[model samples]
Target: MERKQTAELTNLVMVYDDNGNVLVEEKVGSNYRGLIFPGGHVEPGEAFVDSAIREIQEETGLNIKNVKLCGVKNWVEFDGSRYIVFLYKTNKFSGELTSSDEGRVFWMPLEKLRKAENKLWHMDQMLELSCGNTYSELYFNRNDSAIKPILK
Candidate 1:
């Protein structure tokens, strides 16, 4: 028997350095690495903006002053699971970043992130949008799924 399709929303965060570079992290409890962002699942009836702010603060220890929606990505796959992501960008934050459950955080050059191990798959697109100063909604069909946006 096949599983029924279910839709879910994930709040994704991309933290950048003062120079506007993406922060990458080492994988916790696994050898695999990928670009790390401070984000997680959105609770039911939970607003996206609130979720983004809460997730960021919880994961990164930073309180974002200005949060903006930059993208929304939707994915459907053979497994009967559908994933939707609400993307937000914030350039202003307070407090220093600390170690978290996700992993250690470090700033990586946006221009050459694709080659980085544990590199988030969509980084390139996110960096581009960051440059353009626009928020975007991206759609995907599951081949493999990841929401982190890293630069190429």
Candidate 2:
């Protein structure tokens, strides 16, 4: 028999422009290539909000002194390795936007990003759903290996 595991994930307060453009960091890692958000695994005894702020600072060099929970995303795999993403938003911040060891940073129009040929990971759907004012959580499963969502 095999045991199931649930991974605790944390995403940052992905600041967007007034027009709803999102900034994606170019992940710097052996496996994490191309553009990605500034995030990482949640540390033990760390609050989700604190983790998000820390990650954003580490990746973007921005001080998000204020933020709020926008939504949540949950994923359950056949193996039962669950993943949860905490959606946060921030309209105010300080510090200069500098690059970290993670990746080069740039802004991407959220709508344009949605229409990109190279699809983003699962978060794209969650982001799309969260963009609405009437959403709080989104649940779904992965379709094959692609980023497509099989809503639950």
Candidate 3:
């Protein structure tokens, strides 16, 4: 029997301020629309952390450093391929905030963001994982009905 392989790799970074706020991107033109962290797919032969940093800069115009790897989210597709998203967090960054074609980037209070209705599905779980409160997020696709997230 042959083993399945990971088909896609991505990252999600939580950039927070000292004032209890987190940087967010209000995604506009994608199926996974809504508020989300600044991140993107990892390029071939590129480092994971480097990808995270590069994505942040591209999406939010922030130069982040000392990013801490908090956790990961992963799931298997119907085609038997897996997708993995590395979660990271960092309070260290410097740049004039700007928005890109990806979304409108802005800062929101953590508490306020928690209560926002426009957040993407599983944003809460992703936040927990990115904050180191959880080790990983395992997604289950059940009978093509709904996607269930299990935090570990």
Q: What's the TM-score of each model vs. the native?
A: 0.73, 0.74, 0.89
lDDT tens digits, residues 67-110, model 3? 99887777767877778888899999999999999889999999
- Which order, best to worst by TM-score? 3, 2, 1
Best-fitting candidate, measured by lDDT?
3
Best by TM-score: 3
What lDDT would candidate 1 get against the real structure?
0.67
The window of 10 residues in a row where model 3 has the poorest summed lDDT is 140-149
Q: lDDT of candidate 2? A: 0.69
- Model 1: CA > 4 A from native: 1-5, 29-31, 112-117, 133-135, 143-152
When 1 and 3 are scored with TM-score, the better candidate is: 3
In model 1, the worst 10-residue window by lDDT is 143-152
Candidate 1 local lDDT, residue 136: 62
Regions more than 4 Å wrong, model 3: 30-32, 142-152
